[model samples]
Target: MGTMAFGRSGASTAGWTRRRARFAGTAHWLLVPALAFTLALVVFPFGYTFWLSLNDYQFGHAARFNFGENYAALLHDAVFWQGLGTTFFLYFLSLALQLVLGTYVGLLLNRRLHGQTVARTILMSPFMMPSVVIGMMWLVILDPSLGAANYILSLLGLPPSQWLASPGLVVPVIALIDTWQWTPFVALIVVGGLQALPIEPFEAAFIDGATRWQAFRYVTLPMLRPTLLTAAILRSVDLLRFFDIIYITTQGGPGNASTTLNIYAYRRGFEFFDIGYASAIMIALMALVAIVVLALMRLRRSL
Candidate 1:
């Protein structure tokens, strides 16, 4: 009777194991659709762009494989280098301004205040507007003559100066424009981070007689590194690929002062029809954005 019971138990365990294995195998099929979508949209486009980068193709002409000549030419292209420098300049400037202003605004919003809901909605209005609309709106407002910005300058008894028309000021002006539109986004992220943070550390700091700034700098800031880095990573990607507003306002002018890699690529591909070279420029920009995001991720991990 004991030997028969043991044989029956073994058979039951083996049957259950087989059933579990079959269920696991079936579960994997659920991922197939998502994988197919990613392959079709992301992988294919990237592979095709890379292939185009290696060729010397122009619009309305046959593609000629040139063994990386497009990239090689990019190495010696002065405009490309200049555009890269401008791109970084705008990227860093815009990012710094946005982070600082956004974090400050976020801190303000985190506190209990009257009319906080109304203020947040008003502040976020710019971010909700379409980029093209913002561009067109600013273009009108920043017009050197007969624009509100200059009119306000005149009201202050200060001489009105060119805002976007001046080459020296265009990049910084654009940076400020972007900061105006996007800082609220960073602030929103920061507010979320602040609300999620554990309160114990802040309480301890206060009990230890730490001032508000000290508490923020030493306690709050350290805890918020990951959140801040997340904001940085998101902003860095957008800033690097900045094109729409600049294109609408300056079109890579006043004389390439505000030209970024994205603008340059657009001109090359759409205007000049240098399809292959433009693809290479885009590939380079992608690499640049990837490197910065990865570095930020590493820093976040270290913190």
Candidate 2:
């Protein structure tokens, strides 16, 4: 009887091992399509763009390999430098404003308030809207002559200044428009992080007679480091490649005042048909974005 029981146990163990192996094989098969799709969509385009950057490719002509000449030309290009300056200016300014305002808004929403659900829904609505739609809507609203903004300024006994038309104000206006659309996204992430926090520390803070600001400053801020880092990383990456809002509103003008690197690349490649130079500019922009993201991610990991 004992010998029969031992044989049955050995047979069941072998069968279970075979079943587990089969399950793993099935999982590997399921992942094959996703990996193939990613390669086709992402990897292929990246390789093509890199190849384009290395040659003297232009519209309606055969590409001759020019090695690094395009990148070298960019080093001497005034417009490219101006675009990079604008990109960094808008990126840092918008990110700072968004983080500050988003944190405040997130804290406000976390409170016990009437109509909270409606407020959250309305606040989040902008993030869901297509960026192009936001751009168009704001363009109409910021129009110097017919815009409500100037009309309100007129009513307030103030001057109706040109917003996007003025060189000095164009970059800031673009940043403002972008911040208005994206601050809610930052807030949403903040809210998620806020909710996951342990209540014990705050309760202890309460027992110690800590003020609300004190709790937030001391305890909440420390807890929110990871979320803030995440928001920064995501927002910075998008800002580095900023194009849509400025494209629809300014088209990199009133005379290239709002031209970011992305806009610069578009103008070079599509408008002027400088494919090789544009490819170099775009590749450089991508590299800068990658470096920024990696640095932020490393900071996040440290935190």
Candidate 3:
């Protein structure tokens, strides 16, 4: 009886050990599925795109793996370079105007004045509209011959200028559209940030005989920096990949005046069906965007 009991006890102990090991093994197996999912979805696709950038892949015929040739070709491609420059130009111009205008509007709305709520609602409505719809709406309003803008200018006895028809005017007009649509978004962010600020500095400045401008310059501006930088960084990232409004309105055209890097890549891939070249351009653009974001983040941290 004692021997039999010892054998049963030993068997039970071994069974418990085996159960714990199985549980740990199951957990390890569970991790495999998650890792596989990430590799299949994100890592694999990214790797493939990088590989395509090294080849001369087209829609048909034998694709050649021409290492670094596409990147070299981009250097000689005047249209591509022009588009890149135009993109940067538009980005900087719109960013500056939007920051200034949006901040001012935010300040105004934050004031304890009559009809402030109504005004805010009206201003923010534009931002809620779809980009394509905004583009179409602006097309009518900016129509040179018969639109409201031209009609008003005509009433003032000025010549009816071709707003978007001229290549020189196209990008500026697009910037205007962007500003109108996005300024309210910036303003809303600023207004929220302003409301959250401590009032002590502002009150102290006022007590020390600081005029409104002086108080703003000394107290308000310093306090607003972080929020402003945050808004600017977010806007910059969005503007770098800007596509919808440009696509809907200009189609990167009237002879490539408003063409930006995004539009250029689209043309290369879809219009021309040069996948490898387009992939190279896209990788380059992504790198540029990543660098800009990193710089912006560093600057924010320093501030």
Residue-wise lDDT of candidate 3 within 89-206, one digit each (tens)?
Answer: 8889889889999999999999999998899999999989999899888888888876898999888999888887889988888888999999999999899989999999988899
Write model 1 residue lDDT over 1-303, tens digit each, in one string. Answer: 787888988898899899989988887897889999999999999999999999999999999999999999999999999999999999999999999999999999999999999999999999999999999999999999768999999989999989999999999999999999999999999999999999999999999999999999999898888999999999998999999999999999998898999999999999999999999999999999999999999998888
Model 3: which residue pairs collide?
none
Number of the top TM-score candidate:
1
Each model's lDDT comes to 0.95, 0.94, 0.89
Q: Comparing 1 and 3 by lDDT, which wins? A: 1
Q: What is the lDDT of residue 68 in candidate 3?
A: 81
Q: Candidates' TM-scores?
A: 0.94, 0.90, 0.86
TM-score of 2: 0.90
Q: Each prediction's Cα RMSD?
A: 2.3, 2.6, 6.9
Using lDDT, give the best candidate's number: 1
3: Cα error in model 2, Å: 14
Which regions of candidate 1 fall more than 4 Å away from where they truly are?
1-16
> How big is the RMSD of model 3?
6.9
Q: How close to the true structure is residue 133 of candidate 2, measured as C-alpha lDDT?
A: 96
Clashes of each: 0, 0, 0
